[model samples]
Every structure is written in C-alpha cells, then in structure tokens.
Target: MKQIQRFFLVSLTALLLTVFTGTWPTIFKAVARSSNPVYVAQSLNDLAPILQQLPTSVRDRLTTFISGDELYRQGDAEGAAAFYRQVKPDFEVSDTQILEPIYEAEALSPESLADWQQAQLALDDDDEAGAIEALQSLVDREPAFIPAPVQLAELLMEEDEEDEAIAVLEEAATLHPYSTEIIMAQVETLADEKEYLEASIAAREFALLNLDHPQAPEFQALADEYFEKFSKRRRRRSIFGAIGNLAAGILTGDRVPWESWNSAVETAELVELMLASESEFGASLAAEYREQLPLVEDPDVVDYVTQLGLEVAQLMGRDFDYEFYVVQDSVMNAFALPGGKIFVNSGLILGANSQAELAGVLAHEAAHSVLSHGIQSFFRDDMLSQFADEVPLGEFATGLLSLQYSRNQERQADILGTRVLATAGYAADGLRNFMATLVAMTESAPPEYLSSHPNSESRVAYLEEMIQRNGYNRYALEGVDKHLAIQAKLS
Candidate 1:
C-alpha cells in the first residue's frame, strides 16, 4: 500500500508539472497544502522531473523545504530550524506550518528555563552578581541558548566589565552567526566604548555576509556612521600631530618637507610611477584609450563638468589634483583612473535631470579616486608587482578596465560620495535618486554605469537613511537650469 501511494503521488506531481508550467506558484501551493504533507515530503525525490521544470528560485526554496522536512523527521529539530530560517521570511509553506519548528527549537528546555527564571529573579532582587553567575552557568551548559549569553553580557556590562561582556557576546556571535540580536548587541557595546573602527567593521561584515536580510541596509548605515566618526577622530589627531611637528622643527632649526608625510609620499610615488613613460601602466593606458575614444572638444562642455567635479572633489578630503574630461559616447558611463583622471560619457550628461545628479555621479567617481580603490585593487591582486616588472601596457590596461569593486568598496564610495555631495551644497539624494533611475532603467536594459556599479533598492534605502540620519539638506540645490544649459551644449 505504501509503495502504491508513493507511486501515485509522484505520478500526480509529474502530471501537474506537465499541465501547469506557467502556474508554478499554484502547483507549489497545492503541494504544500496537501493533507498528507509528510508523504508529499517523502515523495519529493521521485518528483525530480517536476522540480527540474520549476524556476531556479522556486526550485531552491522547495529543495530547502524538503531538506528541512527530512531533518525534522529524523529528530534533528534544531538542524531543521536552521534551514527553515533562510527561506521563512519570503517563502511560506502552508501558512508557515513548515516554519513552526523554528519557534519550537528556539524555546528553552525545562532545565534551561528554570535557570533563566532564577536569573530573572536575581535581577529583580537587585542581586547583579547572582544574576550574572546564574546566566554564565546556564550559557556554559547550553551554548546554543542565545538569550542566556545575552543576559549574561548585559549583567557584565552593568558591572563595568566591558571586556568580559564583549567576549561573551563575541562567543555567542560565533556560535550563532545568524543572530542579529547578538551581533547588534556586540556592535552597540563597541560603539559605546568608542571603538568606532571595530564597530564599523563588525556592522559592515554582517551586512556584506547577509545581503538578503531585511536589516542589511540598517547595518550598512550604522557602519557608515561609525566609519565617519573614526575618520574624523583620526583627522583631528593628524592635525594636532602636524602642528606639534611644525613647532619642534622651528625650535630645532630643522624643517621636514610636507611631501615626506607617509600618505602624501606614497601617493606621489604611485602617481610618478604611473605616469613615468608611455609604456607604463596607468597614464599610458589612459592615453591609449584617449586616442581610440572620441572626446568632446567644446571648451564650455568640458569646463562645466571639470568645475563641478572639482567642486565635489574638494569636499572629499583628498588633496589630489583632480581632473575630469568628457567622452563623446552615448552610454551612461563614467570611470576614474588610479590617480585623479575621470572620464564622463556625454550620454551621462544628457541622462541627468539636474546638475545635482551630474555632480552626484562625478562625486562617486571622485570617491573612488579619493579612497584609492583602483590602486588598492591592483595591490590586492598583486598586479603592482607586474606593473613594476614592466608588464605590457595593453595587458595591464585590460586588468585595470576589468577591475570589479567589491560590495564593501562600492558601499564605502556611496557613503563618502553622498557626504561630499551634501557638503558641496547639492541635494543629498542626488546619488540615490540617480541610482533609482538606474534601477528603473534595468527593467528595460541595464545602463553601462550599472554594469560596473551595481545598484539596488537596498542600496537606495541605505543612502536615504544616511541622509535623513545626518539631517542633510536635500532641498539646498537642484541646478536644473544650469544642467539644461550644459546638456544643450552637448546636443
């Protein structure tokens, strides 16, 4: 009877696939709502043909559900819960009957529950040490129990044992990487202790690792805030140190060259190396492209873009001699070279609805230069050694053109670019609104700019939040009339 029932279910599933390839959601719903869900789950292997006909996203969700069902039947409820959590937010199975196991697994067992209650009682009685002791023992016994460690960390923090509290949350995060609660706790603690860099890194890593999570943008924004704080603090220290060095030099009758500063010296060396000869990497490659690519010669058009770019570039906190040029291409594209050479396609100018939008694009490219993303990319892939060895300019240019910025790098640019845009008195949402335009354009065909710089709704949301959180004045400047005049010159 069992064999016959399994065969019948598989045959029915295959028939449904044959008849309803276009109605995949209906078919999956029917299967999930089957009266004998366990039997349907068991017969999933025999429905391989049907699964193959489904779209990849749907197929993946179904596969995850099937794996979770199998684990649940095998008595590993905890393991099943882990799998269910991934698909639970967006994919529902029989009104989340399939996801209920996660809630069940999250509950404490009788022994752990009693211990938790005791800790709460101690806290209520103002016995902080007792609560801490109880929570520590409970967490040690059941490391997977998330709340125990959280409570213990809170107690430790109240007792002014910040290091131990951070350690406790860190261990908990290692054990439960999926727990946003634990990670956020850790980030807040680090930020409270003024460990801005560490907090920024932690938040950024979480967002990068879990891009699909609903809270990813929030984490990314937090990372931006902390990183900005860190940068400001470092800048303050540098200024004071520079003043001290100047005074000492005057007293000792010895002057240090400004170019001898580590960052300036390193940047100067890189710039010199890149522009050393026609056969060298950066400048040679840029020159080769200039010969092939049609460029705008109208002084007005070029000057307009160069002036706007320089306006935003000054606010980027980098003192490089920034330069901008316009390419006679109908593709919405712009790119920055290793130093400060930026090329903007004519189409990008016509694509902008306002001057703020154009400034936003230029600022983003300038941020790439200011952040030294191109140079870092070369060093990261050890291409600098090749450049030193005098690799053929064509081959080196190929590598440079094909460089894809990591998601983290892209987010950093967006954050910094937005900051400079607002500081330059342009609308703070200029970059974000431009990204939304790209997102809309993607529905038809993706823009060339997006090919290199991926844009998404989450990225837009984060920029919006960053603007609002910092109280940036988005209504300050639109410059639509000025932008139209520039567009007219190109036309």
Candidate 2:
C-alpha cells in the first residue's frame, strides 16, 4: 500500500513539474529563460495565483524577497534564513532558477527596500502609525514601488480606512497598470462599496491587461454581476411603469394563447439574461477551481492538448477559443466548465492506451460546452431570473461541472463527440475503446469520468452503430509519438 501511494505521489509530482518546466530530462538544467521586462511582468502575473494561497504575511515578505536581490548577493544567508524562519524555518531559496529573472527585473531601489524593512519593523513593534508613515514615504518617493502602495493600502484597510486604502490602490494602479494586486484591491473595495460602475470599469481594464490570467475570468464575473445588478435596477423601474399601465387598464387585452405568449417572452428573457453573464460567470467559476488544482506546466503537453481541443472545437462548427489544461490528480477524469476551458487529470492521460482515447475524452467535454449542457443542467429559468439577478455563480460552479446531465444530453454529447473525432480525422473507435476501458475498471473504485459520463453496454453499442451508420474512418489515427513520449516521462 505504501509503495502504491509513493508511486502515485511521484507520478503526480512529475506531472506537476511538466507544466512549469519543459520536458522531464531538462528539469534540472541550470539555465534560466531569457528575461525582459515583458517576460518578468507576465511571469509575476502568472505567479499571483500560487502566491495568494500562502498566508498574507508570508506572501508579502516572499514578494519582497523575490523583488530584491541584496539578501543572497551580499551573503546574507543568515539574515535570509532568519527572515524565512518566522514563517517556515525549513524553507530554502533553492528555486533560484525561477527567481533569477524576477530579480533581474527588479525595479525597487535599495532605499525603497530599506523603507519597506523599516515599515515591517515598525509594524512588528506595534507602531502602526510609524509603519504607515514609512510605507507612505516609500510610495511617495518611489511611485513605481508596487508593494509599498499595496502594503500601505492593506494597513489602511486594517484600520477600517477603506477609502484611504482605495486611494492608495488607485494611485498604485495608475503607476503599475499591469499589477494584479493593485487592480484586485481597488476593484474589490469599489465592489464592496456598491460602486459597481467604477468597479466594472476597473475589472474590464484588468481583463484586457491579463486576458490569459486565471483572475481574468473572475474579473469578468465581477463585471457581469455589476452589469446584472445595474440592469435589474432599471428593470425594476420598468416593471413599476408596466404595473401602472396595467392598473390604468392600458394592457387590458387578454392573450388568447397564454402558453405561447408566456413561452416566447420567457425564452426571450432567459436569452437576454444568459447573454448578460452566463459565459463569463461560468468561466470565472472554472478559473477559481483552477487555482485549487495543481496544473501541469509543460508547454508541450499544454499546446498539444489545446491544439486538439481547438481542432475539435472547429469540428463542432463553432468558433470557441478553447483552453486546455492538465490537472495533477490521480482520478481518471475529464470535465468541462461553462466556457471553453476543459481540465483533464494526469491519471487519465497515463491510463489511456493511446492518444485516440484521450482525444475522445476531450472531444466529449468540448461538446458539453458547445451544446451548452452545463448551463442548461445547472440553472432553472425562474431561479436565474430573480429581480436581484445576483446569481450564486461560485456556489454552483464546481457542482455544475460535476453534475451529470440527462440521458438525452449525455447521448447527444457522446454521438457528437464521437463524430468530432471522426471529423478531426481521429479513429472513430476512440470513444468506444475508452468507454470499454471504463467498463472494465468497474471492479475497483469507478473513475470520476464515469460519474458524469455513465458507461453502459447500450452506450458502446450505440457508438458502434453510429460509427457504422456514418461510415467513419475507424483506422485513421490511433495515437501519436508525443503521447508515448509523455507517458515515458511521467513514468
């Protein structure tokens, strides 16, 4: 049992490393990637989600350490060790390859670092005012010091001075428009204050700056929430006017076909509401889940998966900017969020007999998004149309992704996805082979893939019949060399 667990753990680690590093053999290469301001900026943005999972104090100090190089260069290992000891004494700066470029992109001058240290000391001594003063002075002297304003804003917010905190954030945002910290702080504060208009504007700007960021979808959700709220406010006023008209006998004519009229109006309203926020809301929920999952960082695997998804998407007859990612979970599962984002577990990859099997799974999930089964399965019309219009997106996101669809929806996705494989020139037997594999695994714990996608003799029979009826090329493409290479690396 211990050996089994250890094997799984090592496999998971290998998959996790695949994301940030290139191939497995190159993982220990001593060279850092070429660094420029643009690369550093993007790298820091990518690191935001990981850093945010840590305790706030530790995250702050770690950010400072990454931005300043004096500690290691000046042989202050003792001092660095002492500083890290406060958080996790066992922590070492061994990931210097990752940190080198960030250090090279340091914009914080030595004086600013000194002020930051002083502010930290003041805060440690319980001199709140002194810390604020020092941080404020640092911000003033070095407007480009991204952390100073953030620290100052945090201090202000702690004292219940939210307005001042927002002011500091706004100034910081102007100075560093691409800084995720500043934009998030300002947007969240404005949002909490019900300043939805301003918040929406800031969130939009943030989205444009960080389109590929995990936080980008969250900002989209925020903007949609604000828009929904603002729209509903106007809707309520219009409702009142309609009520007045009804009271005045202005709309007294009775509808002969009440069902037809109601259905049309309801459908229109649902369409409008969906147009208002569903895609962004769904994408945001997926983004949040992504932060919780350890993602594979290998560009090669990511590109291969994404390229396949895009091809399947093209075959779906829709133009979706599909995003594919690998999750470092042992569960053999693949699921799609509301948007085009799809996640496949590493276990699924290693378990697949061929790339055809993997492509079949991806095509199936992509079909769910293309067919809007996720949206239809999760939300009821009236539930989504409350005058408040405050959809509990976060509450439903993970649940919705895990929710099983109706038999009809499942069948449609299966047929369509199988057809997509054929259309994309992959073996039509991919889905059939994969489902057979799932059925064979029923003796042990069932794979999570079978939870949402129930496998049965009938389903496989239908796939076979469909393949015959359509005369799909069952032997076109079975797998690729890259898939075998990836499996070897993971092993």
Candidate 3:
C-alpha cells in the first residue's frame, strides 16, 4: 500500500511538470505518450480561431510565439524567454505591410515625433481654440505634417473662422502642392464661395499650371464646365426670366418675381447670392443655392433650417456669416447669396425634415456660384449690350444650355450635393427620401421641385447609388441631439 501511494504521487508530479514548460508539439507528444485524448482536443480548440486570420508570415511568427508560450506554461521560463526573443520578424524600410499591430508600429516616417500626438491630445481635450493655435504653429513649422494642418483647418472652420483656417492650409499647400488634399482644399474652397467667375478661371488655371501632370485633364474639365455653366445659366435667366418676371409683375399687381430693374432680375439674383455670402470669407460670391420650400414663416421652422444651413455652409468651405430669411411663399423656393446670405421662403423652410432637402438647395446654389452665374449673367444679358431683345442668348445660344442642364451638369450637382451632406455628417439619405416623398406628393398635388429642378427622379437615384458606393454611414446626430431638443423648445 505504501509503494502504490508513492508511485501515484510521482505520476501526478510528472504530469503537472509536463504542462508547465514545453512547446505544444513536445507537450502533446508527452500527453500522447500518456494517451491523453482530451488535452489535445482542448489545445486545438484554443488555437483554431487565432490561427485562422494569420497570414503566412504572421503564422510563422505565431508558431514560434505559441511554442514559447507553451514552453513557459510547462515551467521552462528561461527557455520560453529565449524563444520569444528570437521570434520577431524583420521588416525592411520599403516592405508593403498589412495592418497588424506589428505593421502599424512602423508606418509613415514623418518628422515632429511628439508634436502630432500632443496635438491630438489637445484636440481631444475639447479646447478647440487652443488646439487650433497649437496645430497652426506646428503646421507652419513642419508643413510635412499631414494631420496637424488638416485638423487645424477643420477645427477653425467649425468655429466660424474660415480666414484663419484657409491661411493655415495655404502654408501647408506650399509644401504639398501636388498632393490631392492640398490642391482640393485651395480650389474647392474658392469654388464654394461663389468666387466662381474667378474660381472657375482659377480652377482652370490650376489645371493649366499642372497641365503636364496626371490630374490636369480632370481639373481642367471641371474648371471649364463650371465657367461655361455659369455663363449659360446667367444667359438663360436673362432670356427667359427677364421679361417673364417683369411682365408677370406688370400683368398681375401681385408682388412679382422681379419687382423692377433696381435688381436686373437675372443678374441681381446672382449678385444677391454674392452679397449674401459676403460675410463668410470663403463662402461668398455668385454661387447656386437649393433647399426645401416652406409654405409659411414660423420662427421655429426658420431656426431649425438655419441650424442645418449653417452646418452645410461650413462644410463647403468656411467663413459663414449667413442669415435665414423666412420668405412667406409656398413655391418650395430657396436661394443662396454670396457672403453667407441664404434666403428661405416660408414654404421651403417648413417643408424640410432632414438636412438633405436643404442641402439639395444649397448645393444647387453652390453650383451656381462655382459656375459664376451672377457675373456671367451680366455678361450674358450684355446689359453691357452685347446683344439684343432675345436677351443675347436668344434661340441660338439657348440651344447650348437650353434653359435646363444637360444630364452631366445636373448629375454633377447631385453628386456634389450628396458629397456635401456626407462630409458635414448630415443625413444624405434625407435628400433621397425627400425626393421620393416629393415625387409621391407631386403625384397627388402640384410638383414645384420638378418645374425648377427638372431632374428630381434621376437626382434621387444617383444620390442613392452615391451613398452606397461611398459607403457613407448615415449621419450621427448624437452631437446635435441636445440642440435639436432645445430647438424643439421653440414649438
């Protein structure tokens, strides 16, 4: 009985030691030697999931680590440490790597090692003013630091300080001109402000400057298209809307579209956009505007729409001193002005549910600005007197723009509108939903959007495809939820 007890105790001690400091292969061999089926199955289950995602190189490294860990488990701490120290793989400077922890440990080799990290910490601290100041300095000094200037621009822009943000970006642009980011920032900001007559020309000039480069063709086309579109919209409004509004006013003593020549009717509309956007440094000029039409004026509705308007306005560029006028009309009419001025009819204001419907309006107006519709309108009407009665555009030039856009221009604005809403973290789907509702509503009632927009269905469909292609998650209003509730206090 004493011999049996001693033998059993010896067997238990050996089993426990085997479990402590050996590789899996060795441990399993020992277990197999002991004929233990359950331990092998348990080990396989533990490793299977982790092994599945491993690439070949990772799997190789993992095999070594697993071996070391197993050895440690079996009680050979020194041996385990030796194996772990030997297991790491060497990555060369140019090695294209996956996003594993090991790979991220060695990405972009930029200067200013701690500056960006510190900047991020400052940003997360919610001291946006301080964050902007610090980041602006870092960007000015390094210029090569991508994250700092971009974040700085975004932060300042959000705080309604476009001029400062634009200045910071301009400095960054000097270092990274060909970088898509810098170029887009400079050109896109100008476009957003309705500096189009100039902006379009500038966009073209930028393309010309880079003509020998890869992006030249696309940029050139965008610039030219913007210029020509503005020229034509101005021309079209001059021709059709000119006598149309004046005659309507004369024909009906009602407050007509254009009260008198005090405005030029066509050109003044464009000019109005410019004047409105004047306060917002980068958001002024003869840009296009579009938004839902309100049937009546309510301060509560105006407040809601203005909040949304300001949100989208900042996304287009920066410098947003804008106003939301509650026009008491029901034609679903809204328009944009240069210098951050927005005119919203009561009809349009009350009609918007989400920001997209408003975005649709804003983007359209932005397109107008980008194309320089106002300045070009002056050119078109030749109030400078370049042509006669048929408004200079007449039957001949109308064939070019045709008082409606070719599918390309309409699609471009819709695509851009979708992008604008998405960038602002607004619900882009709201535009699509608004379109569907409008279409359905139009079936039952008169459709104001179509008479003006003409391509509502296609625009909505395109927006849908865009959101899917870009994989934009619907907007998260958690940041604005409280604001929305407080505004709800108005009602």
Best by TM-score, which number? Answer: 1
- lDDT per residue, candidate 2, 289-323, as tens digits? 77778998876667767887777767764355677
In model 3, which runs have C-alpha deviations exceeding 4 angstroms? 1-300, 318-321, 337-340, 370-406, 478-491
Clashes in predicted model 1: 0
Query: Against the true structure, whose lDDT is highest?
Result: 1
Q: Estimate each model's TM-score.
A: 0.47, 0.45, 0.38
lDDT of 3 by residue, 114-168 (tens): 5555667787888777776667666655555566666777887789887776676
Residue-wise C-alpha lDDT for candidate 1, range 1-491, written one tens digit per residue: 77456545644653443233211121332233333332211435644544554446656665665565456556675676576555433211221101111122238677777777889899999999989988887787667776677778888888999999988987776545456887799889989888776676667656744557999889889977886776566445445544554555556655454423443334334434553321243455577678768999988788889999999988765456677889999898999885567889998887675567789989888877765567556544656445432344555666686788766567767777887898887767778767766665676688898888875656776676666656876654555444544554564
Give me the displacement of residue 401 in model 1, in angstroms: 1.3
Model 2 lDDT at residue 383: 35
lDDT of 3: 0.48
> How large is the C-alpha RMSD of every model relative to the true structure?
20.0, 24.1, 25.4
Model 1, runs deviating above 4 Å? 1-285, 384-390
TM-score of 3: 0.38
| Candidate 2 deviation (Cα RMSD) | 24.1
For each candidate, what is the lDDT? 0.65, 0.60, 0.48
